[model samples]
Target: MNHHDPLLEQLNQLISEGRNPDTLHIDTASTLDIVTAINTEDHKVAPAVAACLPDIARAVDYIADALQNGGRLIYTGAGTSGRLGILDAVECRPTFSVPDTLVVGVIAGGKTAIEHAVEGAEDDHGQGALDLADIRLSAHDVVVGLSASGRTPYVTGALAYARQTGCKTIGVACSPNTPVLQAADVAICPLVGPEALTGSTRMKSGTAQKLVLNMLSTATMIKQGKTYQNLMVDVNATNHKLKARARRIVMQATDCDEATATDALQQADQQAKLAILLVLTGLDVESARTLLSQQNGYLRHALKAHC
Candidate 1:
């Protein structure tokens, strides 16, 4: 190892890298006991995230504003952090009926890094910015940088470049007062403390990142009218299972029978929100679609406006 590496010093100061006093005996503990110990630490994740709800909500506002203005939401990270971002981005399409280009994920080392560890990828800060540039990042986009340790060079670099481009930037990390947090317009650092295995951020840090990303994306989509009450009104019926779900959602939204929901779904081309509007308002497809369009796809708003 290079003794002069600055990251070494930086990592040494990170709370995510410190050993857990509570899990010291985890190595020799029974399997159940080991898992129990892990579970105990896992329980700490939610409250930590709860403490940062303000900043997380603020980040959501930035993302929602960007999306409303026709900009995209982009997440950049490395390792476990990167994979989590990709998971969230991919889910948005099926869950909210969004296009592929709307929510984007960029992992360090490009596509290969998503599956295999690309040596020195996260350390290449310049590549982080380059990756954003390659994606044609604009001021209208929101770039969210995810890093468990809160000091991943790649994430920090991406945040810096995003800021320079006048892009709305958000940093999600598990440690407090680190570069990842410092580089962005909004800092959402949920201090999940030390990992159970010490320096293995894939545990608590990964959990924290997932939780924060969940809120960041889910809340933003909700604000953008992807949901009607608690139902996924905008869900895309892209597959057999999703098609069934879309029908069920319409039924639940309008309290109609399966046949009625199915009929409306067919009329609305399997769009759950539109199907609900058709079922409840007894409107033709064209009128229901026009109302939804007038309300910017907000189902409840469209219903209220028509009523």
Candidate 2:
């Protein structure tokens, strides 16, 4: 027994690192068989994530509360986890019309790490705290730490610092009984079991994390009134595709013809929510805008006020 092999011992205890008995013969399998095996393993991800829905819902409430109080939602992780955080954060701006700063992503080794692996970056726990500090993380904000193993020093450090600063912390991982789970105020673990290729968490683990993240951000945005009756009313119509989407949303929300939708959108300055309001409430752009402002952009509330 090698007493110095602590990492080996740690890996041994992780179900994610264990070999999949079902795929033991994958190396000798045909192409179709290999894909079938991977597909079978992939099917477990959704149910595993479903098991953590209660915790995910709790995190979403915390996140929405933080944002409502003029706070931000920040995510921190390493490698694939880090990339996922960045991806989600960037998408929020265009999807919900929120400022980019409202959703921040902090990786272990900075921007370059998003494209290439930064050797030893995850091991520097202190750097994680520093990264959050550098961004001026505040007590009202929420920090979500992502780590498949749930023991990445970088994520643990960030969560610890977030707690000290009075920020709400949530940990997302693929394994249980981890340091991150213990550190965070809420822990979301999706135990997808061993990978088809042993220890490659970027497979099932990554998928699980992405699904949870989707729920966290989308649900929080919904709670904050970013959506109007399942439509992304707050969408930023910056590009051609988005502008087309905005028109379609107005038509859908109001059940109006394309010409009416187009006229409403133009009168409302191309704002989908305002266009929908104008069509549904039969109000001029200014009155619709005023009601929307009073309701803090909640279209349903504004509609109710007019009705």
**Residue 306 shift from truth in candidate 2, angstroms:** 0.6
Quality of model 2 by C-alpha lDDT: 0.95
The candidate scoring highest on TM-score is: 2
Kindly report which residue stretches of model 2 are placed more than 4 angstroms away from their true locations once superposed. Answer: none
* Candidate 1 lDDT, 1-307, residue by residue in tens: 5568776777788899987999998999999999999999999999999999999888999999999999999999999999999999999999998999999999998889888999999998999999999999999999999999888899999999999999989998888898998898899888888988999988999999899888988999999999999999999998999999998899889889999999999999989999999998999999999999999999889999989
lDDT of each: 0.92, 0.95
Q: What is the Cα-based lDDT of residue 11 in candidate 1?
A: 76
Clashes of each: 0, 0
The list of candidate 1 runs beyond 4 A from truth reads 1-5
lDDT of 2 by residue, 1-307 (tens): 6356888889889887889999999999999999999999999999999999999999999999999999999999999999999999999999999999999999999999999999999999999999999999999999999999998999999999999999999999988999988999999999999999899999999999999999999999999889999999999999899989999999999899999999998998888999999999999888889999999999999999988
